[model samples]
Target chain A: MEKRITFKGVWLPLALIAPQIVITAVFFFYPAGQAIWQSLFIPDPFGLSMTYVGLGNFEFLLSDPFYRASFVTTAIFSTLVTVVSMGVALFLAVLADRLIKGSGTYRTLLIWPYAVAPAVAGVLWLFMFNTRVGVITWYLGQLGYDWNHVLNENEAMGLVVVASAWGRISYNFLFFLAGLQAIPRSVIEAAAIDGARFWTRFRTIVFPLLSPITFFLLVVNVVYAFFETFGVIHTITSGGPQQATTILVYKVYSDGFVGQDLGSSAAQSVILLALVALLTVIQFKFIERRVHY
Target chain B: MVEKRGAGLWLTHVGMIIGVAFIFFPIWLAFVASTVEQQAIVRPPMPLLPGDKLVENYTRALTSGVNAPVATMLFNSAIMATGIAVGKIIISLLSAFAIVYFRFPGRQIFFWLIFVTLMLPVEVRIVPTYEVAANFGMLNSYSGLILPLIASATATFLFRQFFMTVPSELAEAARVDGARPMRFFFDILLPMSRTNIAALFVILFIFGWNQYLWPLLITTDPSMNTIVMGIKQMFPSGDDTADWPVIMATSLLAMIPPVIVVISMQRLFVRGLVDSEK
Candidate 1:
């Protein structure tokens, strides 16, 4: 049966695959390979001389305090954003699951922010945090608390996290809500009959059943924090107040695009790629089994 | 017990209402701020109601300096999104049909390769893509903005997954009717997969419209900027007194298309999520 398949039928798939393969090779594979290549060589901006420096770029990154801080910042940012967004999403999803009325309306309203483009979300948050005109700033000022994210490091980080969490909660909520709805009501009734309270029922019944959704969301939210939050950071502070909020990807963007240091930027990207790949592998290996699906 | 449960439900609804308000307030603020004067915006105790400056702010944002015209940006975004959506749907359908219906060597490997690309985001290869675009002289061109993103791995993967759920008997029936593969794909499979296609279209359109970094990077000319990039350019560096109302107004304007698309396609959007599970 397999041998009977002919070239006449295969041509369309082959043709379809051709464009994808070529695009990936040129845009995805080639660029990634070149980034690795550039990482090994130091390029002089004036003379355009590229000299090979084995592990020198890596050494420079390791030795630099700013680069070191980026690793810590990236870790904290990704983890906090993922954990908080997932928690809020799960909380809302559970609440949404139990509601008898207005559930669909609530779901739609909740997911509205997810529909807003990240750029728009960033801009909106920027305005909301604007010192003079920002609604949040005005509200904080009424309480005699001066909140200026532009100059303070901790405040800047806090604002970014809040904005990131707001933008992220929608996507996470959708997934968790779906996951919650997938759970059979009969299962919850069984627990209810067994005299399980809300917390007890959630712990023993709902939470484990929602594990796969949670795991999937965990990985996705982490990756999103690493890659998607660049626009927010760029728009909000431009990594300002002396590079306080510059995560790894933003650092890569600034170095390569703004600073015009392609070699170091490429090197930084390589590090980021490795870090992401490691996290991905770890999630698959360790967390995959824990996921119910 | 039933009365207590009803009370709990009421409390839950009340809490969710607050949550909804929190989610919506920023957007509402943007809309309200767009209508207010700059001085009024900075005034203590911000106005919760719509202001009189809506027309003036909208006018200034539309007529702003060096920014791509709002009409042209919308046109460009629509053209790019349509091209990408149509191209992706076609490519995905063909490839998914092949993976699902055909008995081919190395089929699983090809499928896996596409799936792996989903995890590897465009950010990783952005620098090299810039160079590739420059090499092809696509910089500052619409082709440059739309071409690289045309063949999406995620779309292909999604279609393949959806097609797998489609019964094999249908394809076999088509072949029994003397239908060639391409003919069956175009006439049978394509039409049957309308829901999946619609879902993919909404997803891709939103993603393409929301795209910022790549478009900003490739399109050096201000004229080529998309709506998102145009909003970004509104903030001038080293300028103390930036135009707040114009910025808010433009950002609000930029959001209208995607918001419209999402509201209209809400059913398809929810269906897409359900389909992903299969």
Candidate 2:
């Protein structure tokens, strides 16, 4: 939407935009273009020259068992993180929404977790579940269940998922609470007057109304699980126990920085770029439609 | 108000308390761990209550961390977060004002260019981006930490969204008074955008503070480490147990600034978070 009245000086406007344009071009566009370009070339091991392989890196990455496992691992990891965080958040939001008053007090209690960094959240959870001194792990041992995420694949995945989702709960809770509050009270009342119980009213009327925000949160939580959980995975398990918890982003980091396989990492990055682009498209299209409904 | 939830109301309160407790348990344990000595923590099933060593542990953390003082890491974090937050706000305000208020050539192209940065997070293009930064000699510098990430167009889109709602008559009246484009921007638009700027500042501050991978890659210097990423470095590399007390204290300290910002600016923080979707 253009402003009806706008200033007419081309150079002045161009001057105003120059900083943003230059920074975006240099930092964002150039690097992204280079990722695409680098995906086609293989660099020699000595950090010297590059060979034009032309899709060789992509082919190798697609076929590598480890890379393929990372894909599956990422899928499972993101799904679990999204589900766990969203489920807990929805539960909290519903309970809070049901409060006659003092939801704000509960909100204040719950949402401070939002302020904790994802990496810090990992440390917090890691402390609780730390193999040696972890209070929770010690308690679990009392229950006769051995808990060692460092050496166990499933346990490591679980720890990373929970740690990543821990801080995320607040974000989902805020949105869910907002969504719940935005549902007109009259509709629920109408359902109640028609002899609909609370559960019935929620499932039939309230849930439908909240679907737009639900969908929005789903996409957002998935993205959070995708890119932002790098800290959680890195700190908690280091994507370990045989790369069980290594998501796509972690693999990108590990390969690019640790392994120094620039070509394959660049290819993975290009694939990830495509993934994010697709997610962005899906978000805009679905969210725009849902909001209109 | 739909129906008197009478007994159900009490149940809701109870459930919420449980949910809140479950969420708070981790931080609570961290705090408890921070207060205790190392032996108390390592022996399994550490005392749940705060120990008398609170001051001692926190003092140790602030004065002398493993590699560098936690105080120094905190200082670096504050600089990085504030720099990124303030820098992005200035650039975004300018570009957004120009986009919304001017009829310039290539405006569409510029908008789309800024918009595209949203999809390309630093994680994806780490290698090449690092190479770019290295080429520019940005490593271990504050500018290196802030500049690349500031290119995001979130606040720009937000300003544009708000500007569309602003009455054109405001700009029209300003023009009649013989105000230049930038003068109108400074005199009228800047003041009008105060709440937005404040709200975005709250959110962006947290974003900047929580950064992990970028700071991890760029700042190999111990003194330059931000607290969020620096905590992981405190963990022992091999055999030795972590320094639980100091590490936990550092964890809580790392959280304090952002938590204080969010609680103090709760209303604005929430507004910024919801609005940041653009």
Candidate 3:
């Protein structure tokens, strides 16, 4: 990665990098190291002493039914958010890509929602689904269907998933549209000349060619669903309705901050740290592959 | 793109319109709710069109929210967002400059050190990070909100990537002209990085503005709240019903800045989006 020519000086380079190194060491490494350290020690109720439990915290978390449920919840939430957002985005991108005019208008109209925070998105969805005053709840009531996210686990999960996925559509759409545009027009036209209809051409040629982007978006979306959706979950369900929406990140927060089970939360944090590290490695590998392409 | 014009084209347009409409409906409704009176929204079947109470609701939110004034929260959010965006850009620029422009002792180690921060997010390290912030007496301060969040390696990585691609001849030429390192960076390199910096600023501003967990943790005082996290606080805690119009107004206010940035500088936003992920 080095350039052939470079500037000289040991202290000068150190001086340049000093601020970032200090911030990284103080804020990034220190807390991360503390999380790992704290995970191995069980603090007393008195908050004055700590007893080292080695891997006991991890063992307990693995056995805990609620923590296990949260794992399942995280899996379900991440999968649903990823699938829904990407599916809708790919569909819209295909539609937009088919247009010879007004695509820019459509892109503008579609992409602004990317700026809406997940928490704000959650609020928007919650306003629609709130049990007492929600407009959707009222409409559903007319059809003799009851809706209350604060009470029902399925409804809560459904709301959070939709809220999380909604704003994500804009991001996924932009990428998909970019990806679709990059596909060779000649290849698709050739498929058309071979008498393939739109769907057939898309399936046989476009989708296969787009798989790299699809895979990239898939991994990226999962990472988003895992980490960034904290706002959505926090604002809407708050891992509530009997913890139906408590994903791993939320569990870590609730355990440490709310529940004050420091060791358990730290253990969960370490686990999440590992999860992020693994996903990041996968993303880097994919990026390297794309560079080769 | 294929230049097809037929019923299929019409259908495609209709499908695209529906998708766009579906995307806009929630935001439209939220906007409508923000403009309407509380009773109008609290009642079933809120009006689809905007109401005349827009100014009233917005002013109410700005002046006296349930927790803190919306104006205060907005100001706090702006400061934190700008602080984060500017702070990260400056430090990352320096570090990336050091790593790419110099081959000093521990260069590789510093590069890897910054690089590995990508593996952990603020959300993962929430509790301990909060503890660290609290210990530093940064609680309820802008520094607490911005500093910990900016420690991520992305901007550094992005800048490093961009620096690597710059022609090495420029540096050699600068040296031949007797320009020192800092002088070269300021007079030459900084000018070259204008687009990248602008793009990164847009994205990072949004990232910082939209932050939820860190602000939620650090800002115990309602006055310290950023608008993004402040909206939730406006909801009544007990049996008291929410003031929907004000809350909705605050939501709109919170989103407007970043949305404007994204829409106005869209080309740069897209470029930054693609480049940063890589």
Candidate 4:
């Protein structure tokens, strides 16, 4: 049924699309262009002089040990957090799928964490892990373990990873649960009749079926671990205990806003953007083929 | 076979119980902490039981500083979420309608554009977005906070996916009866898409309300802050101890709207997912 495009149809779409293009141009494209432009020049805050430093910002980043360390921390943090969180979320989703009663209650309660704003979640967790007054700190003290996130680099990284994982599990669980429920019970019954064990059934049948959902979560979780932990890192550790938690996005924030090094900050942002884009391209090009859907 | 099936179900139940407990523990701790006094909160052995200071905490959190009046912050958050919800739905509906119904010149390109934007997180473009808002003199204004985010790629994508499922015969019948495109969309399509709209609304509302980085960058004035910003400010710097009770109180308060929406629309979400699959 080939429908002819009418005057009203054409005009209405143009009218509706105008605002989106305008807003995207102003807010997304223009600012992105400016950030790229600013990355090339060092702007003196005190002297109010802008000087061209072709590749100097990137060169400075490569030369500086602190900036180099930040890349390592971000890579380790994002990879480890994404794997661990997705693993736990998948486990929880499969478990929840088999529940015959109170499934809705469990789903609602489990997803409650996603409702807590990231900033507030950071504050809440930081309060719990505080050396003097934190509940977790007190519990650790009872076991004769000196647990201070402020002083211990390993503990600080652990705290950030755990907080990031906990904060995001709900969203992953939602998708995984949906994926799990979509699998047919008849297929499971047939697999069981063929003498397959629970583990065998899941690994051979369910896991393969849930691959697309898992892949989607993997991409989201990776992006989140890279960028979304800014508020958490800022509030909890301030990239402290020897800058152990200063990931790329946080570095960009500190360099640009707090440290007033706009050029360096812009350079860091470009690096972050490039890293994310590469991951996205890889996921779409290679990994997406393996997705069952 | 029956006995083995029962055992497997029991094991799954146990795993789910533990999983549910792990998820809820932090929220439970937050609620307990909110009820305690500041002194008790900072003690070496932190208080686990609910304290008698919930009211005092609420009072202090409500009247802390000149920056965010509790009522005003709530109002601002509400306005931002509502505006985004209405704006996103309208734009997404119109755009989705155009892509699904009208065979335009750049329809496929437009569709791909929205999908590409889905992968482009705000973190990448935030610096420039800040500059854009500044240029337009939208800093510290609601327009800055709401307008930039109103055209969500996720919403547009979701609507396009859902709209594709609607039978073209319905639109054909409407057009045959002398109904124009806009009239066909309004009269024939919208009523049928109430469920998808409701689900998308809840999702978009939650996202809009939870926005932090962009809003923080653009809104400098304390009075213009959202609930998340208000909570962040409650954490005092330097040697000054943060008041835990007030922080927890405000945190719990900030969570209420999203919680309410999620609970109320839980059935709708599940139903919509099922229907969309079909």
List, residue by residue over B25-109, the lDDT tens digit for candidate 1: 9899888888989887767566989999899888877766336666667677787777777877776676666766765667777
lDDT scores of the candidates, listed in order:
0.78, 0.90, 0.92, 0.77
Mark the 10 consecutive residues where model 4 chain B has the least summed lDDT.
B269-278
lDDT of 2 by residue, B191-255 (tens): 99999999999999999999999999999999999999999999989989999999999999999
TM-scores of all candidate predictions against the true structure: 0.93, 0.99, 0.99, 0.91
| iRMS per model in Å | 3.4, 1.1, 1.1, 3.3
Which pairs in model 1 have colliding backbones? Answer: none
TM-score result, candidate 1: 0.93
Residue range A238-272, candidate 2, lDDT tens digits = 88988888889999999999988999899999999
lDDT of 4 by residue, A168-245 (tens): 888778888888888888898889888898789999999999877677677778888988777778778888889899
Give the Å shift of residue B22 in candidate 3: 0.8
C-alpha lDDT of residue A120 in model 4 = 68
Q: Deviation in angstroms for A167 in model 4?
A: 1.6
On the 0 to 100 scale, the lDDT of residue B164 in model 2 is: 86
lDDT of candidate 2 at residue B126, scale 0 to 100 = 85
The regions of model 3 sitting more than 4 angstroms off are: B1-3
The full ranking of all candidates by lDDT, starting with the best, is 3, 2, 1, 4
True contacts kept of 2: 0.85
Of 3 and 4, the candidate ahead on lDDT is 3
Tell me model 3's lDDT, rounded to 2 decimals. Answer: 0.92
Chain B TM-score of model 1, please?
0.90
